[model samples]
Target: MYSTSTQKREWTYTPEKLAAVRLETNIKFREKYESVITPEELELFVTPEEELRMQRSIEDAALKFADKFRPHIWPSVKWTALAFFKRAFLVWMVMMGCFYLAMKIDEFYITIDDFVKNMNVGDPRQNAERILKLEPELMKVLNYNLTVHCPYRPFEGHLMDMKTRMLLLNFDLESIRRDSMRFFQNALQTDVLLVYPPSQIALAAINFGCMLKSDEILREFLRKMIGIEEDSWSARDVRPEDLEKLEKTVTRVNHIMREVEKQFVAVTEQERENHKSRLSQIQNLLPILNERRKEAWRAGGCIGQEPGLVTEAPVDSDDE
Candidate 1:
């Protein structure tokens, strides 16, 4: 039989108590992660009233400038056919320039020859990185995505939810947003999107992106997402499997993106020549490595020394 206090404690979880607990949990969740960009706001193409006000202000300023210029230029025939023709000519010039660019795009396409060392590479991760690192002018050729999922949407959603809180925390929100989005973009540049769920991939991106911007905030922000108290969020306490997955995902992300970053960093002609010079100076190190291996084997007794080197010529029973 249970003690009276035990029975009372077990029965203490009443309907009202359960309701209150659930409500409290909901409130806590909202405090930590309520989406700052609501669904309606997301759906709107332009909801920020400030943007509209800015546009209107610009238009009003332009009109006021025109009105002021009109009287001063009126004596110079401001409304003359020559002025109208000048406007038309400028518009035609812009149109023709645009048309020429469109037609001669191939001639103007930006390129850096042979970014990837192996063109015939079959690794999906490597291949994807190659495509992503291809000249930005090649973006039009690569626009249509065939990946199983676009992680950008999910990542943007997650970022929208936490952006305000991150700002309040004195983080450089713009840097975080930019880098995090780039990380997500890089994840798509590899087979990582296929290997991991977009959300998990995004979590990995958030981890790395935070590191790139401000290493200190990564753990603290992750703890906020996990809804744990500051002291209770020690990273070392995470389960081994979970930690391994997170670490592996971040490792793969960094590897894939590092190559993409190389494209942005200029490789000067001198540097290229120096690289070639280093290659020419390089001898086949395989033989040296092999010799070291053999020496290690001999040291470990895995390989025998020269014949009779470590042994007596004979074990003379008479001597013994």
Candidate 2:
């Protein structure tokens, strides 16, 4: 029984806390009223006849309420609208996705052409045919089905601007573009995009792709971009230490994408399905793992078997 003041103020209570409070309040009520109220007297007061009367009254009241709603029932229009909207939204997503793909494909191939010229390939004709033949296998590795979802859509403008900015800094823009595009292609096929934000993923892709560059200006740009996005901090506000830390994060993201791409290339579709199933099972156990930790904390036990120590961790759920 919370105090009346709790109603006036904004009070938040967890289920366990609320239940404990309620039980304690009832115990105090019983202790105070023990002189006039006894358990035997309370039991006799709620006799069988009284219980039946309460049940009958409840049922009658419920029927009366139901009768009021009978005239208002208009054939459940909300569910029908909901179903239509679901289908319509799915269609819209598909259309927009197709548009994005077309634009990106044109851009990608244009850059690829320039990249090819820069490399001065020994046999451009053979290379073109080989790339065309590999298209189906590449799509298979991407696990692309009916839907084509990508994080790149949001970062598209930022990256284009980044290229312009890098060129002004006198950096090797051509190599950065080629390598970053390759990393982006590999990253699109991996789950890293789901794990990280679009900005971070883009920076990581670029960071890993441009590792051989001597300038290190792109890394500084990325650190500032990420710092500003995450903390609203300007270029001058970002410390060298923070820049170094974020650089490591980008490197890690790139490494993970590379590893995932390797695995995707190595595995067959059947093996991929098996891997997916195992990952699903492990994911299902995550909630139970967190609940176990909570139980240990409540019992004054640490997760690693130490006494009187509790560990609290924020659970990272997969929303995608």
Candidate 3:
């Protein structure tokens, strides 16, 4: 279904495209503010990589919240929620709003008060209000696309295939399933979901799971699934280049997983504190930037209101 989905047509990007898009976005940011802010102020802006790291931290925190959510959130819902976060660089509040939206879209509805309480967001009424106000923006950022296909089902399919078709894999498939599930969980923290097809991700997880089990099992799985022997000159159907490409992709996914894990482990509390400090600088700069934009709009005879300002009203403190 992913082959025929809108996600494949519109959302998917090659590695080069992704890098070019990030470069263009950064260029646009500088172009927008170069005239309004001093060079020193502009120098304070976070680089694209730093911005990505900050977003990843917030995303990991959101994932933890989703894991502990009551009534047990679906894996699909969690993946969809993260997809939204990755698509847009939003603040912590809006990220939660995205999660709430993903839940509703996935038919896992929880009352706003319940969500606030269960998520331990302080001041239920205010938090609910904030989430509601930002819901539309989150939806718009996602382009109202709610359907996200994750690798879990395909992952299970691969396990089932192995159990049914591969007689050589006579050992308990449950162990492989468990290891694959963990690999998939760790993959969620990386860009594999965005960069690779679900089937490929599933295959990579299975491959890693087999590797964790034993080298013999790994060799067998690779032999059956990847047709390792088919690469021989006697093979008539399979192209060597195609097989090479497949192997490269699987290796790349594993490499990405390890690299991202290293990056996550390297992040110290002081590094996070530095990120917050940089955020404060941006926050302080936004009001001036907004005012300048408003002035320019007014000069063009177009009235505009200030954005990103939340007016908190007195509301119920006890949402229980």
* Candidate 2 accuracy as TM-score: 0.30
lDDT of 1 by residue, 1-97 (tens): 2122221222223434534544554354333222232444233222223222322232233223333541132211211112221122211111112
lDDT of each: 0.38, 0.41, 0.70
Model 2 lowest lDDT segment of ten: 73-82
How does candidate 1 fare on TM-score?
0.28
**Better model by TM-score: candidate 2 vs candidate 3:** 3
Q: Whole-model lDDT for model 2 versus the true structure?
A: 0.41
TM-score of 3: 0.79
Q: In lDDT terms, which candidate is top?
A: 3
- Residue by residue across 237-307, what tens digits does model 3's lDDT show? 66677567656765765665564455444346677677768877888997898788667666778755443
Q: Residue-pair clashes per candidate, as listed? A: 0, 0, 0
lDDT of 2 by residue, 118-194 (tens): 22334755644554554443323222221222334434555676765445555554556677665654443333433
- Using all chains and alpha carbons, the TM-scores for the candidates as numbered come to 0.28, 0.30, 0.79
